[model samples]
Target: MAHRFQYTVISILSAVLQKCGLRCTRKFGKMLGLLLMLQTKRRMITYDNISKAYPGHSDEWKGALVRGAYVNLGITFAEMLYSKALSADDLINQVTFSGLDVVAERARNGLPSILLSGHFGNWEYLAMAAGVCLHKPLTIVVHPQHNAYLDAELNTIRTRFGNIVVPMHKAARTLVRTIQEGGIVAFLADQHASADHDPQIEFFGRPTPTYSAPAALALKFNVPMFLGTAVRHDTGKYSVNVQPVPSADLSDNPESVIELTHRHVAMLESEIRANPHLWSWQHRRWRM
Candidate 1:
C-alpha cells in the first residue's frame, strides 16, 4: 500500500511538472534549490567540499557556487522527470555533439566502447543520446534504488529511449557479452567507492576513491573508450562533448588501470572546475 502511494505521488508530480514545460519547471526547481541550501548539515558538507576543491576562494564565491550546485541539481531532477515525454528524435535533437565521429566510427566498424562520465550535468542524457547517435543500444550500469516501486518507475524513464539498464551487481556478465556482441556500455566513474573496492584515484588534487570499472573493462576487452558530458547552455539546450579517453598506455599492467582511471578522473575534474555549479556538491565526496 505504501509503495503504491509513493508511486502514485511521484507519477502525479512528474505529470504536473512536465505540464509547466522545461523552462518553467527549471525556474521552479531553482526555487526548490534555495530551500535545499537552507539545510544546515548538507549546506556545511557542500561548503567544505567547495572549500577544499578550490582553496583561496572567498566565502561569497563558495556560497554562490554551492547554491548554484543545488539549483543545478533541481534543474537536473526536473529535466529527468520531464524526459519521459521526449521522443527518441527529440532527445537526439536536443544535444549537439563533439567527437561524434569516434562514436560513429566505432559503431560502423562493430567496435564496442566504454562511455564514461561523472555526475556532472545531465549525465542521463549522455547515455540516451549516445544510443540514438550511434544507433546501437547502450548498457548502463546503475545502482538499484532501494524502493522497488520507485526503481521500476525510474528505470522505465532510463530505458524508454532504446537503452538497456543493468543493476550494478549483475552488470559484469551482461556488459561483457554486450560489448563482445559489438554494443556500447556506459558507467559513472565519479561515485564514491569504499577503500576495499580498488578505486584509488586523484580527483581535484585530493586522493579519493573512484570506480575503476570503466578502465578495467576497456583494457580487459581491448575496446575503444570515450569520455563525454552533456553541458547545459543558457538557452537550456545541451551540448555534448565526446572525446577519446587520453591515457598513457592501456596494457594489462596493474599500474595501467590506475593511470587510466586517473585520466578519466582528471577529465571530469576539468569539467567540474569549468562550471562548478553544474556539478553536485551536496554529497560527502571528500574526507576531511
Candidate 2:
C-alpha cells in the first residue's frame, strides 16, 4: 500500500517536472539552479568534497564550483526532458565527438569492446550519442534507485534512444552475452564499490575502492578496452573524447588485465585534473 502511494506521487511529480522542463527558459533555469543550490543537502556535500580535494582553493572558489555543478546538473535534467522530442541533428549541433574512429575500428573487427567513463559532463547523453553514432546499441550498467517509481521513469528515459540499461547485479551475464554477440558495453568504474565486489586501487593519489569487473570481463573475453569522457565547455555545450586503451600484451598472463585497468584509471585522473569541477565531488569515492 505504501509502495503504491509512493509510485503515484512519483508519477505525478515526474509529469509535473517534465512539463516544467519543456517550458523552462534560460533565465528560469538559472533561477531553478539557484534554488537547488540553496536547498539541496547533496549540493552542500559536493562543496565539502571539493574543498577536501583541493585544499589550496579559497572558500569563494569552492562555492563557485558548487553553484556551477548544480547549475550544470539542472541543465542536464532539463535537457533530458527534451531528449525524445529533439532530433539527432539538434543534439549533434550541441555536442562534438572526438576519437570516434577508435570505436569504429573495434566494431569493424567484430570484437566486443568495453567503453569506460565516469560521471562527468552529461554522461547519459554520451551513451545516447554513442548509440546513434556507432550504429550499435551501447549497453550501460546501472544500479536502480531505491524508489521504484523514479527508477522506472529514469530507465525509460535512458533507454529511449535505443541503448540498453542493465541492472548492475545481473551485469556479468548480460555483459558476457553482449560481448559474445559483438556489442559494446559501457560503464563507469570510478564509484565506490563494496568490499567484496571491488578491490582497492590507487585513485587521485589515494587508496580508493573501484570496480574491477570491467577488467575481469575484458580479460575473460579477450576484448579490447576503450576510454571515453565528456567535458562541459564554457559555452554550456559538451564534447566527448574517446581513446583506445594503452596496449597490454597479456597472452601469457591474465593478471596484466588488472594493471591495464589501473592505467586506464590513471588516464581518467588526468582528465579529472583538467577540469576538477566537472566531477561528482560529493561522492565518497575514497572511503573504505
Candidate 3:
C-alpha cells in the first residue's frame, strides 16, 4: 500500500516534469532551490559546512555559496527527470571530453579502470557520457534508495542509456570480477562511509571518513584508476576532465590504501575549491 502511494506520487511528478521540458524544468528547479535555501535545517547545514571549509569567508559569502549549491542540485534534479526524453546522442553531446585519448588508449589495451568522481555536477550524466565514449556499458556503484518504488524508477533512468548499477553493500566481489573481465567500474568516492569501515582522509585540511573500497580494489586488482569531474559551463553544457591516478599512489603495500584514498579525496577537494558552488555542501561532510 505504501509502495503504491509512492509510485503514484512519482507518476504525477514525471508527468509534470515532462511537460516542463529541460530548460524550463531547470529554471523551476533553480527557483525551488532558492525557496529551499530559506528552510532552517538544510540552510544551517550548508552554512556550517561552508564556514568550516572556508574559514575566513563572511556570512554573505557563505550564504551565496549555499544558495548556489542548492541551485546546482536543483538543476541536476531537473535534468535527471527530463533525461528520459534524450537519446544517446543527445546525452553524449551534452558533455565534451578533455582526456578522452587517455581513457581511449587504456580501453584499447583492454585495461579495466576505476573512475572516481564526487557529488559535483550531474554525476549520473557523467556516467552516461562515459558509457557513450567507452563503447561499452560501465558498472557504477550506487547506494540504493530506501523507497522501493523510487529506487526502481531511478534505476530505470540510470540504466536507460547502457549502464549497469551495482548496489554498494554487495559490490566488492562483483567489482573485482568486473575489472578482471576487462570492464569499466566507477565510484563516487566523496560520500561518507560507515564509521567502522571508512578510512580517515584529509579534505580541506580536516580529517573525514571516506570510502576506501575504490583505492583498495585498484591496488588489489592492479587496475588503473582515474579521477574526473563533470564541469558545468555557462552555456548549460558540460565538459569532463579526467586525470590518471599516478601508479605510485596505489602501491601494493597495504599501507598505501590510506595514501591512495587521500589522493582521491584531495583531487575532489581541489575541484570543489575551484567551483565551490558546484558541490553539495548541505550534507554533513565532517564530524569535527
Candidate 4:
C-alpha cells in the first residue's frame, strides 16, 4: 500500500516536472540540493570523504568541490527529465568519443564485450551515446527506484533509443544470456554495495565496497572488458574515453575475479584523480 502510494505520487510529480521547462528542472535540482544539504546526513559524509581524499587541498577548495558535486547532481536530474528530447546529433555535438577502435575491435571479433563505467557526468547521456556510436543497442543494468510509475517513466526515457534496461535483480542471468547471444552489456560499477555483495576494494586510498559482477561476467564468458568514463567539460559538453582492460585468462579460480575488478577500479581512480570535480562525490561511498 505504501509502495503504491509512493508510485502514484512520483508519477504525478514526474508528469508535472516533464511539463515544466528546463528552467523549472534546474530550479528543482537546486531546491533538492538545498534540502539535501540542510537535512541529509549523507551530505556531511560526502564532504568529509572528499576532504580526507584530498588532504592537501584548502578548506575553500574542498567546499567548492562539494558545492560543484551538488550542482552536477542537479544537472544530472534535469538531464534525465528531458533526455528523450535529446537527439543523436545533439549528443554527438555535446560529447566527444575516444578509443572507438577499442569498441570496434571487440565488435569485429563477434564476441560481445562488457563495458564498465561509473556514475559520472550525466551517465544516461553516456549510455544513449554508446548506443548511437556502437550502432547496436547497449543493454544497461539498472536498479530501478521503488516508485513503480517513476521507474517505468525513467526506463522509458532510458530506452528511448532502443537500448535495453535490465533490472538489477535479474542482471546476472540476463547479462550472461546477452553475451552468449552476442549482445553488448554495460555496467555502472561505482554504486555502493553491501559488504556481502561486493567486498571492500581500495578506492581513493580508502577501502570502499565495490561491485565485482562486471569482472566475474567478463571472465566467465572470456569476453573482453573495457573501462569507459564520461567527463563533463567546462562548456557543458561531455567527453567519453574507453580503454581496454588488461587481458586476464581467468580459468584458475573465483579469486581472479576480484583482482580483475580491482584493476578496473584502479583505472577509474586515475580518471577521477585527473578531474575530481567531475566525479560523483555526493555518494556515501565508504562506510568509515
Best by lDDT: 3
Task: Score candidate 1 by lDDT.
Answer: 0.83
lDDT of each: 0.83, 0.75, 0.84, 0.80
Tens-place lDDT digits, model 3, residues 28-110: 77887787787898789888889989999888888889989999988887787778878888888888788767777777888
Q: Tens-digit lDDT track for model 2 on 1-288? A: 776688686566445555664345334455666677776677767876777677898999989888776776666665664565556666566677898777777787776888988877778777788777777788999988787766887788788768899999888888999999988999887867876656667776676677877887777788878887788776666898888777566642446656776877887888887887677665667666
What local lDDT does model 4 show for residue 116?
82
Off by over 4 Å in 4: 1-36, 249-252
TM-score, one value per model: 0.95, 0.86, 0.95, 0.87
Output the worst ten-in-a-row residue range by lDDT, candidate 2. 21-30
Global Cα RMSD, each model:
1.7, 2.9, 1.6, 2.9
Residue-pair clash count for candidate 1: 0
After TM-score superposition, what is the CA distance of residue 146 in candidate 4 from its true location, in Å?
A: 1.9
lDDT of 4 by residue, 168-271 (tens): 88888889899998889998888787786677888888888888888888888888888878898656678888988885655535688888888899998898
Superposed Cα deviation of residue 284, candidate 3 (Å)? 1.8
lDDT of 4 at 85: 52
Q: Name the better of 3 and 4 by lDDT.
A: 3
Evaluated at residue 230, the lDDT of candidate 2 is: 80
